[model samples]
Target: MAFFGIFALIPLVGVVYFSMVKWNGMGTPQWVGFDNWSASLTDKTTLNAIKLSLIVMVVTWGVQTPISLLLGVFMAGRQRYRAVLSVLYFLPLLFSSAAIGIIFKSMVDPNFGLFSHIPVRWLQQSYLSPTLALPTVMFVITWAFVPFHSLLYQAGVRQIPQTMYEAAMIDGASPWKQFWSITIPQLKYTIVTSSTLQLVGALTYFDLFYVMTQGGPGDATRILPLHMYITGFKSFDYGRSAVISVILAVVGLTLSLTLNKLSGTGKMESQQEGI
Candidate 1:
């Protein structure tokens, strides 16, 4: 808690303070009150970035979460070659985001790359197309992060007692019914935790976009973090960048709390503590 306060809490307070000022990050900051926040709220580029981030968040939660849950369930079930499959599933998580992005970029390169012979221009032009850019980036993000979420779900699944499954089987419960009634209810806490992590990650995603697309072609994939980076370093508008940071922090916190409440994790934790 002391370390968290010193490192995380202090920096967060600094960010909030800086957001209310006009600073270029070098000289003394000028107090501009709510000007920076007002400007950030109305900025078209920032708004677009927020929209793209939200799209990534929704797509990740919708597509990646279910897939991870299913993979976790499958891996947790009795199966041959489970160890090898687990290693394969976890291999992607070992790679750095930059490395993954660069490898995928090269693989999808239009010419002289792995998919060069494929006649389709999905990578060449369509990846940068307005309609496809966000989805393409979302796919890459999902591919990179799904392994971690799957591991979380796998742990959750392993915690379930095998006797429950045996009883369900004896009670004539089909696999699908058991899954829906038993597996999902038991995994609620894991689902909430995984979704919160993914949501926060998606909102502040930067490295993948930086290495792969650099928020182009024409800002199609410019998430809020990328926008903040550009405003702070490239444009030297630190105050506005700080504003974006504060916004992201608030949004992430609110959504995470809401998810916990809706998933009943908070109540479950309290009940467990009481017991």
Candidate 2:
């Protein structure tokens, strides 16, 4: 596992190092210290991308986490129909992101699409304007990710001992109180893990947004990945792209670490007592 982890981290390390240098992908590289990072921070386009990425992350977190948790707990607690329901919820995870994107595009199409029949041209109307496109894309991404996160949540909830619930009931705790004192505390690790996974996924998301909006009616849906694509491939500015990629990676890693610390799951034995 350590060997595989090292191999996986190699590319990430390369991108971070490359961000501190000037290179066009084919030429000899030159060290530029923090110039690329500084430029990425100050550039308007980069700033917009950062804003869009944050919007997507925030919306996805808000929408996906709660919905998935409810569905997961509901499904996990139902023994008779659990298998059937789990399959239904997890189906989205089995499909390609591109397929999901294509489906949403048609669903939100400006004219003749399913959404167009509802009076509002959801994808085209200024009411659902381009500036708000990032959240729209986040909605679709959230839908696609919910099932996978639900499965994680279900697994976590299942690990919680029945004895704890029994104890809560013996103490005359209400269902809400039991949930607060027992279910939630026990599920802390799962919640944190799911949130971290979603954060990292949202931060690097590309396929669903790319196919659904191509990052815009203008530059509205542009995110870090799309911004990196524009810089490295479209604009052919490899150095700047590497810098953005590095920022993205650091941001993702940082969020994961922060959430891990909050949940105490990184120290499982210590966490057991608190839960």
**Best-matching candidate per TM-score:** 1
Off by over 4 Å in 1: 1-28, 119-126, 267-275
- In Å, residue 169's CA in model 1 sits off its true spot by 1.1
lDDT of 2 at 188: 80
Question: Which regions of candidate 2 fall more than 4 Å away from where they truly are?
Answer: 1-35, 119-129, 267-275
Question: lDDT by residue for model 1 over 1-275, one digit each (tens)?
Answer: 79877888877989876754433442227777778888888999999998888888788889999999999987886677886798898988878888888887777665666656766655355454666767777788888888888988999999999999999999999999999999999998888888878876777678888898888888888888899999888998888888887787678778767777798656422110000
The 10-residue segment of model 1 with minimum total lDDT is 266-275
Q: What is the lDDT of residue 187 in candidate 2?
A: 82
Model 1 lDDT at residue 246? 76
lDDT of 2 by residue, 54-104 (tens): 988788888999998888787788676877878787778777888988887
In every candidate, how many clashes are there? Answer: 0, 0
RMSD each, Å: 5.8, 5.9
